[model samples]
Target: MPVDSCHFRTKPIHRNTLNPMWNEHFQFTVHFEEMCFLRFAVVENNSSQTTAQRTLPLKALKPGYRHVQLRTQHNESLEVSSLFIYSHRTEEGPAGGATASSLVRFIQVCCF
Candidate 1:
């Protein structure tokens, strides 16, 4: 799965509780929505390894809020670990008032 401007990171919650929230927002331009996977990862500060992660296939996503279940690096599900997010897809024609043959699509994601 290929994505444009795909890499994004959120600020750490810094709290000691099991349920942490960042309320981060991110956007990405995807060329092919059917062949792309939206991947989310949690990493500690100054560490390259991911603490937990989840991947969602764009083709299966519905426009609305969703609770995405997360898993450990070894692909084991973590109880009560998930992401609450809202995602929507928008389509636009070519820039500069050009023809509509080439449409651009953007996926806007908001996490809370």
Candidate 2:
């Protein structure tokens, strides 16, 4: 997904099993959390077309792990998987820096 026109991506993990684990981490510097929305897409490695996609608001997200029911663009049920999200704000910082007073939201979407 691209945040504010800047693309950020994670490396794809290939496994023979049905359940593949990727213990990875991604970090981003966000300017406006309230105005931000997440766009998630799942595409086949051999194809350019997206099989599943979702655009979600940052404020609607919650911390910790939970199951997210995915749907295609047609609104049909796609899959149900686990997701984990975490957010942190600093108490003191320079101007324009993230602080507790200033609003900042974090969202993590992981499919299991």
Candidate 3:
């Protein structure tokens, strides 16, 4: 996707757990998937401070379930922090003699 950046926060924080299963689905439409980067950040509810985050290029991700590593604000890897997610990419075929295909897809992510 030809997106510079997209940000969103998970809702209704699951209390008393390091691993939170969000089961949330997100979709985006863009011209080129290779130019997009997906960023996920975890924040502390009370203080609104981001605890961990990760950024990955859309083209570098493989379809299906995967584990993404998380890091601290300083860019240091948080040894045990990661996100379990499922990504599916679909391109619509040219319709009604249209020359360009529609780029749309869904990505499901769960936090840890």
Give the CA lDDT, 0 to 100, for residue 25 in model 1.
Answer: 81
**Stretches of candidate 1 above 4 Å error?**
1-5, 95-101
Candidate 3 lDDT over 1-112, as tens digits, reads 2253556666856665666777777765545666677788888888889898988887788888888999999889999988888777666545555444354444444443
Pairs with steric clashes in candidate 3: 1-32, 1-33
Could you give candidate 1's per-residue lDDT for residues 1-112 as a string of tens digits?
4435478878767785477777878888877666788788888776778888987788787888999888998889988898899988888877676444466678888988
List lDDT for all candidates, in order: 0.79, 0.53, 0.71
Collision pairs in model 2: none
Question: RMSD in Å for candidate 3, one decimal?
Answer: 3.0
Against the hidden reference, what TM-scores do the models get?
0.80, 0.63, 0.78
Ranking by TM-score: 1, 3, 2
For model 2 the TM-score comes to 0.63
Name the candidate, 2 or 3, with the larger lDDT value: 3
